[model samples]
Target: MAGDGTVEWGEDRPVRLMDRLFGDAGGGGQRLSAPAAGAAVVALALFIAAELVPWMSVTQQQQGIGPDLPSQTSDVSLDTVGWGITAAYYLGLMMLLAVVGLVQVTRPHTRRALTAAGFGLSAAMLVLLVGAIRRAGEGGQYGPFDQGIEATVGPAPYLAIAGVLLVVAALVISGWRPVMATGHRRPAPADPDEDDDDEEPGPIDLTVTPA
Candidate 1:
């Protein structure tokens, strides 16, 4: 408000930028509810754990030339953080940004957008994991061994999928609007006597009157 009683819309450059990115402070930014916050935390933990754990395992077997010679077996495990660093980095970044947005952003629309983006990223990760697992299953021959390799999907991918579902759950929980209760009793009618009593006594007779 200005001295002239008109509303002022001017803002500093940084403040404008902040409002554009995070949200308007005057709007009273949205924050995650308890259940939604818990779900998000769990999802983040699951994603981190998934990155640490082995996502897939490949086993190679070589048959012995003769009965005297022994067969050889080797195993290779793929980890998200180790082999899929790029994907993990992006997913982690998205999750972090989502958490930050949920906590700090004031605009409901901005929060919703962040939640949607997080859910999309999580779903994309799951899809990539499924595709990778399927591709791994179609193993090719390696080295001089005639026998081909076998690939098995590991627990890490499933954990990641679980995390993705949780992310969606969090988003749903956050956006859920509670139904407002109705059927309140109306106020009782105002007393006419009370209204009469509220009236002010006006104009005392000041002129000299003969009784």
Candidate 2:
């Protein structure tokens, strides 16, 4: 109860820590912007497409008794590594980014966190991609390729990287904040007027007069 205490409206309610920083940010359905939303969607699409395309390839020649013997040619795609490559791991991360991006499009309050998350996820992808490449060299052969072979980075992985970068950029550009009307306040209950009868006098002794 407050010092002057007229019941201290809403005093009993809990306040979320986030509410203190950004205020209530009106939880309405307004979106960030059409271009930003479109970019997010496009990023998702590009990521998916990149996953399906070839990302790496390797070639090797087998020694034969005759010099005229032909060497075999082989190629591999991003799907070749499956979950082994960091690029493959990004499929799930990209999906998560897509979901967060969609929410940010509609919920302005989430932009700050969403932008941070996107950047972090992208950075992780880059680190993993480099790790995957390094691991390929350590084994004397890239993933799934024959020994003593050098794997060439393919266009698909590059495409996915580009897509992830775009998502980060899109998030940075989409700035929005909704106006918070007011902090939660309990409504004041109406007080009874002194002029109003508290209770009706028992049905006026009309029946008692006959006795």
Candidate 3:
């Protein structure tokens, strides 16, 4: 505690913490190009939209027990029920990457790391989706009926694919052609040479005596 009752911290404690939390800190913050930023936002929106679409469909067929009733067929789209749980898992990962992009969009290193992570997540999700499809084709059962329940993927996963593609595109664009969104307003580093810039010279004496 100091005279003002404030605990004294080391000179670089807070700064070092901020750097660790938000990546390298120094001259100024980074920014993404307008198109890149817009695409990122769109990706976020698409990902959210995907949650509402159907992810799986099933068809059922039945035969008449007697002779009066004809065979019946019905189609069922399991929207947010069959594969919604798995898609929710993927959405959680996507949302994490999206938050990282929005918060540290200008930090190239951070963005690169996040992009790589996103790619890994997408790959993992792809593998799981393929496995699920294979299982469904192999006569996976949804209920008591086994012979007529044919499962197929719906629109939700496709929407997720679009969202992931958009996110990747934005990251690639910003990474390939880096641009500063702000002007030259970075703080000056501490140096003896720049001390004079901060020091204000006393006003010049303008009054002059009669010659």
Candidate 4:
């Protein structure tokens, strides 16, 4: 026992850990920030946009260089209409990703699900990109990724995926602690006097019993 009756472990508490996972709360500590996880979700969204933009179509009418030449207006399909829809759907799913990211950034348990979501999002994005590429009527200049899907699953599939991802992320992050919605950490047994070395021992009798 030290003079102050406290045990000291020389390991320094990490500053980042303190700021992100352990903030002072009068009586205890808890996580404070979750920006990194949020960034991951944003990145996924941006990637989706990249794919969608490349696949979305724009109407254009071009005038002939010579006045006699006349003008032409044409409706164009931006490679993969279906893949573009898919990408846009994923983009819309950002809301769920936001929640998942927050959960991941605030707690460590979410690491797995976050990683998994990231992987799934990335793969989906790639699939969208590829599907878009395949739909590319103009094979001249193009970005590598989607060949494009002919048919799309629409917003519902994306919504379902978003829900699944969020649920997975939530489950993963929930491992950090148990919450009953009342904001209480379930419960734990308290330390008893017997568990302490400073606890006093009862006096012993000098008289001995004969065996």
Best by lDDT: 2
Q: TM-score per candidate, in order?
A: 0.53, 0.56, 0.53, 0.34
Per-residue lDDT of candidate 4, residues 121-204 (tens digit): 545644554444444433312333334312222232343434444444443444344321222233356557446665445666
TM-score winner, 1 or 2: 2
Q: RMSD per prediction, one decimal?
A: 13.3, 13.9, 12.6, 12.3
lDDT of 2 by residue, 1-211 (tens): 2133243433476765545533443444243444455667787887788767656666565675877766655566544544456445657575557755665544556767666777777787877666655553332234444563556666666677677777776776666444344457535556765464344545655555565
Number of the top TM-score candidate: 2
Each candidate's lDDT (Cα)?
0.56, 0.59, 0.55, 0.44
lDDT of 3 by residue, 48-137 (tens): 776675555655555547655544433333222336546655675556466437534547667677777766666665555555445444
lDDT of 1 by residue, 1-211 (tens): 1233444545533434323332322345443355665677887898788767666565655555665554343333443214464456466547654654463333567766776676666566666767656544454123223254555566776786787788777776765433322233224676766645233456677888799
TM-score of 3: 0.53
User: What is the alpha-carbon lDDT for the whole of candidate 1?
Assistant: 0.56
CA lDDT, candidate 2, residue 6: 46
Instruction: Name the Cα RMSD for model 3.
Output: 12.6
Steric clash pairs (candidate 3): 30-106, 31-106
Q: In lDDT terms, how accurate is model 3?
A: 0.55
lDDT-superior candidate, 1 or 2? 2
Off by over 4 Å in 1: 1-31, 67-105, 140-146, 176-211
